[model samples]
Target: MESFPTELGVLTCLMLLAASLWIPYIVGVNTAPAGSLPADAPDGFIRIPNPALHRPWVQRAWRAHLNLLEQGIPFAILVLLVDRVDGFTALTYWTAIAFFWLRVAHAIGYITGFARLPLRPLIFLGGWLCCLIMGYAVFAARMV
Candidate 1:
């Protein structure tokens, strides 16, 4: 087993993922109407009205969510490997948390569509920083 930092980092990443996915579910549920939807909903209970195809935020949110899911699996693998190796550090824990925050912020900002262009880039960079930091932690832990 690794130190407490690694354990905490793993849990943080998991929670972040949960939050990331949860937001979409919450949005769908809350946005959906009572009488608007069917009582005995069929296969696809919720039929979402696609926000707007041309908008960047609409595309960005969808893309970012998928990207998060994509990278998330690898993060899990790295964390498990770290635990198996019984290794990790402060930087690792913080980096994982930072990545999660960045992802969430990016999703929120982009999905809301208020902040455009430069602000979007800044948020995007936040997510990138998260990836870079987490990647470094995983590599550093492996070398230990």
Candidate 2:
């Protein structure tokens, strides 16, 4: 197996983590009792009257996955640009790792209903900081 850079490996792991968030959502939908579905649900489709109101955790899982996508796009672009333009530095590597861990925390907190009040936002900010740091590193490298 070819050894990949630590930064790249972290990025790959983040991607997988983002994908993993969907598991809870899919399972939640499939496992819900048929009787709980809306009476007007299509013959072959499972439909709830109001998923966000009735299935908050499922909504949380789905939103957590979406949040990852929203943040991951920019993070991925920055990491790739940094790697291609100036190579990964210690800052980039550590930032990537921090971002991954922060996201993990966010996802767990969100899905498990532990993301109360400031906690979730704090975790999100931490990940955003990591992205900012990495983005700055790329800009700084270009200035050198």
Return the TM-score for each candidate structure: 0.57, 0.89
lDDT of 2 by residue, 38-63 (tens): 67666655454345633678778888
Worst 10 residues of 1 by lDDT: 49-58
User: Which residue pairs show collisions in model 1?
Assistant: none
Best by TM-score: 2
Name the runs in model 1 displaced over 4 angstroms. 1-61
RMSD of each: 5.5, 2.4
- Across 40-66, the per-residue lDDT of candidate 1 in tens digits comes to 556554445343322444455555566
Number of clashes in every candidate structure? 0, 0
